[model samples]
Target chain A: MIKWVDVYKAFGEKKVLDGFTLDVHEGEAVVIIGYSGAGKSVAIKHVVGLLEPDRGTVEVDDNDVPTLPRKELYELRAHIGYVFQFAALFDSMTIGDNVAMGLRKRGEMSESDIAHRVAEALELVDLPDVQHQYPAELSGGMRKRVGIARAVALRPKYILYDEPTTGLDPVTSAVIDELMIRMREKLGVTSVVITHDMRSAYRVGSRIAMLYDGRVRQVGTVEEIQHTKDPIVRQFIEGRATLEGDAASLAAPGPAFESGATARGGGAE
Target chain B: MNVIEATGRWVRFRVEEAGRAGRFLEEAALAFGSVRSWLPNATLQMRRLGVDSLPIGLLIAVFTGIVLALLASYSFTGAVPLYFVGTLVEKTITLELAPVLTGLALAGRVGANIAAELGTMRVTEQVDALETLAYDPDSYLVVPRVVAGTIMFPLIVGVAMIVGLGAGWLASIGLLHLSSDEFLKGARMFFSTFDVEYGLVKAGSFGFAVTLIGCYKGLRARGGAEGVGNAATQAVVYSAVMILVLDAFWAMTWLHGRS
Candidate 1:
């Protein structure tokens, strides 16, 4: 299980996450949805020890992520896979090498074993027989699949996807969504996907969590989130702008809203 | 801002930058504790940073040798023997020109390339990807380049020294109207093994500085294309400036008591 408890993180004056909290139990997919710059990515980054929360705890299997020693952190990370938004493929390396990176780092597998696993992972992502190609030669969708292949090459127990389908065409996005679902079902891996695409959230998420104004606004199944009565939730899902009076009221001075107000005021002046 | 406030900000920026550089160096040193994973990359970088640089380095050394010989001939007009021009060329190339000039040239070539490559990776999140993959970015990305630079520079400088002396001898014999025997005698007159060793030491130190500064600038790059461009430019400029500074310091300290 992965749990973020009252996570507070700020970059300069911009409080990206304030008392944000969420939990993902074993063997389930929980997609966190939020608008751009809403800290969805930041929240997932904490799970992988990529970013540390300033004032709260991030725990994976009850191991404190931020305070873990280097060796222990690396050991923990070996069991988790992170897929980046841009694929983040090592351009200089061949696709095969890119997929094999994590496996090679473990230093326990033979060369032929690593090669066999790379082929298997690529086949799982439906990207068979492009091992010799470089990332620059692959299409965006293919690169994203290669990124996924790289992540799953180690057969990690958990996978974190950061905006996995953000820039791809709708058809390609659907393909990626299907791959995410398939990976979870087949591997029994706990999955956390961070994305703003509502369609993708509904497609891949067993449960959807909405992040807003620095904290989780709601957590529910896809059907529950679609019919949620909360105006903020409704406004986001419907992609509708807040009415002027409602916007002003929502922006009113309050402790829960202080960071947003300060950030906007500072940006304006 | 007021003048005092501006000065304070500048000081703070410099101090912060120094602290960052210190920390980066520490991490790079720690990376050496795990050299097995980085060895293959280090060899590949040696080809890129050292082997590919050979022709340009040699060309520069040859021309510098001819120029130094020509200038020395002008100084040896009447009283001094024309052959001493050979000694001057030999000593100057071995002690100063070959290593220092080669380092400056590579600061522009290798340093800029390292910075640009790493800066692009930073912007594209490749370094973050490595970290996420449970790989140490310092060991995987940085140590290889630094190790290549430190190891290859002296070898490059050795080639530069030999080619430079040979070109200087040819130039002296042809342009200065001196015999081969006279030039060879002058070249061998005051040859000390120490001068060559000191030059290689300088070469190695300069290589480390160039690569470390390049990696530092690249890794710290933020924003986007503009930041990458800035990092590349700063890598070359800073590496060159540091090479000159190290040159002066080496002269004062390493060569002071011995000379």
Candidate 2:
């Protein structure tokens, strides 16, 4: 389980996450939906200790992520797979080598065993027989799949997807959404997908959390979020411009939604 | 901003940059503790940095040698002995020209390439991906390039020295009508092993400076394509400037002190 408790983070003077809190239990997909700069990616990054919260705690399986020692942090990271938005494939390396990098670093597997596992992971992603190809040679969707293959090659306990379907076509986005669902069910791994695509959230998420201002505005099942009564949530769900009074309230923001907004929000449960 | 405020900001920026450089050095030192893991990458980088650079180094050395010999001959018309042209060419090429010129040339070639490659990776988040995969970026990305540079720089300089001398000798004998024996004697007259050692030291130091600055600029690159381009340009410019500064330091400290 991952828990972000009263997290506060900022860059220079801009507070990106203020008293932001969320929890993801084991073996479930929780997709965090927010605007482009809403800090959804920042929230998931804390779970893997990629970014430390300035004033709160991020715990994974009860291990304090930010304060963990370097060795322990690496050990923690070994169990968490992070898929970058751009695939982040090493251009110089072949697809096979990219997939095999994590296993190779562990230094316990034989060359043939690593090769076999690379093949298996690629096959799981339905990207068989493209190992020798470089990332530049692959299509954008294929590269994203290769990125997923690389992440799952380690058989991590948790997979963090950062806008996995952002730039892909709708059909390709559906493919990625399906892959996320399949990976969760097939591997029984927890997933935290950070995306603004509501369709993707509905398709792959076991529960959807909407991050607004700085905190989670609402979190519940897809239907529950869709039927939410909160004006902010309703406006966001319908992709409508905020109504006059709603805009005024949201625009006057100095961390407008206070801490514990999640608790008071009816849709949170 | 007021002049004082502007000056304060500049000072702060320099201090922060120095701190970052110090941190980079610390990380690079730690990377050496895991040197065994980076050997394969080091070997590949050595081939790329050293072997591929040889032809270019040789080309520069040969042309500079030929030009030196021709210019020295023009000044040899008076009481100055024609044989002295050989000594002048040999000393300048071996002690200064070969190593410094080769380093400057590579600062543009290899340094820019390293920065551009790593900068692109940074912008694309490949380096972050390495961190996420539990791989140390310093060991995987930096150590190999630095180690390769330190090892290859001296070898490239040695090649440059030999080729430069050979080209000078040929130019002296063929173009200037100087006898082989006279030219050879003049070349060997004032030669000292210390000069070779000085060149090697300079070469190694310049190599490290070029690669480290390149990697530093590349890793720190932000924004996007424009930032990557700027990093590559800065790598070349900084490496060239550092190479010249190191050259002057070596000349003042080592050569002058010894003489």
Candidate 2 wrong stretches, greater than 4 Å: A244-269
Look at candidate 2 and tell me the lDDT of residue A111.
98
* lDDT by residue for model 2 (A1-269), tens: 99999999998898889889889999999999877788988898888777899999999999999999867888888899999988999999999999999999888899999999999999988899899999999999999999999999999999999999998999999989988998899899899998878889889999999887778888999899889887767766666443222332456444434422432233332
Residue-level lDDT tens digits of model 1 in A65-163:
999987799899999999999999999999999999999889889999999999999998889989999999999999999999999998999999999
| Top of the candidates by DockQ | 1
Quickly count the clashes in candidate 2.
0
- For every prediction, compared with the true complex, DockQ reads 0.81, 0.67
Please state what fraction of the native interface contacts candidate 2 reproduces. 0.70
Give stretches of model 1 more than 4 Å off. Answer: A243-269
